[model samples]
Target: MSDLIFYTNPMSRGRVARWMLEEVGAPYETVVLDYGTTMKGPDYLAINPMGKVPAIVHNGRAVTEGAAIVAYLAEAFPEAGLAPTAAERANYYRWMFFAAGPLEAVTADKALGVAPTADQQRMVGYGSLDHVVDALEGAVKANPYIAGDRFTAADVFVGSHIAWGMQFGTLPQRDAFDAYVARIMGREAAARAREIDDALMPQPVS
Candidate 1:
């Protein structure tokens, strides 16, 4: 067994982690778990009490959450050049967390039809979905990549959100978003990740 073990369900946000793994070009074993069964079983629970997919155990240390996994792998395998340099650190961490926190929350709330009122908006981190969307738009429009000139692990996290958001209709189809997605998704690593996950997705019965 490799020192790195990846636990994921292809249909889940695990794809984000999978993409990062591909970018890192590391040899890791994949463990696919089914919902309500192996995913929630005590064995897996020990690894992640949240019973979530896309958890990684590298050198015997466990890391969970898609964004964290992306960041972790970048640092763990620095030769991949995915980790941000000193100059790119600010934008890298900023937009990465923005997508993980506000962008993810607002989109989920929107999908579930759970809109916050004006008074409640102040308490919510996202404030409003439009605000989050506009912020993301500006972030992508400001640079070729999220961190600046080069693609960082931040792109893996933020780009996954943008790509998935556009695909599922959670985010609007703006020209800037369209162009950004096209640019990042065109990466060879991104294509490899999609092919792997797409093959793993459940197929319909004949």
Candidate 2:
């Protein structure tokens, strides 16, 4: 039996996990949850009580949250070489958590019609919108990728966030983001993931 089972809605954050699955070259079956239907179904809800997408089952265990899923897949498929080395552990965990924490906060705040004032933004952990962007800029500038010259599973998580932000206009498309995304999107695994998910988007109502 395949060791992985992935539940997702193509239109949601599932796309990010799909990218990570591809990065690790992990073999898995994808059960596409129907909107307003499968996600709320008892069978699906049991897998993720929050009714969220991008949840995975590996080795008979379930994992949720985009960052957690990415991290899990990296370790689960170590042969793929998608995780950071011992020396890069700090950066690996740092950027992965940042993507899930601060980035999520900014995206949620923007979505909830709660734009922060300059002062309020300063008091926030992310500091300011520009600060977040600048930090990302410097991280990529210092290394060929987020965790250094190597591409790790952290990139799959963090880079996916950058790619989505740039595409949706939520995050500014600066040169660093542009170059970093270009490098990530060029990966063979990422390309395969995009092709599969893109082709399966929004299946017809039956």
lDDT values, one for every candidate: 0.94, 0.86
Q: What overall lDDT, based on C-alpha atoms, would model 1 receive against the true structure?
A: 0.94
Task: For residues 22-111, write the lDDT of model 1, one tens digit per residue.
Answer: 999999999999997999999999999999998999999899998889999999999999999999999999999999999999999988
How many clashing residue pairs appear in each of the predictions shown?
A: 0, 1
Tell me the lDDT of model 2 at 76: 83
Return the top candidate by lDDT: 1
What does candidate 2's lDDT look like per residue over 60-167, in tens digits?
899999999999888888898887798888899998899898887886676677778878877667766677778777887888888887999889888988988888
lDDT of 2: 0.86
Which whole-number lDDT from 0 to 100 does residue 71 have in model 2?
90
Candidate with the greatest TM-score versus the true structure: 1
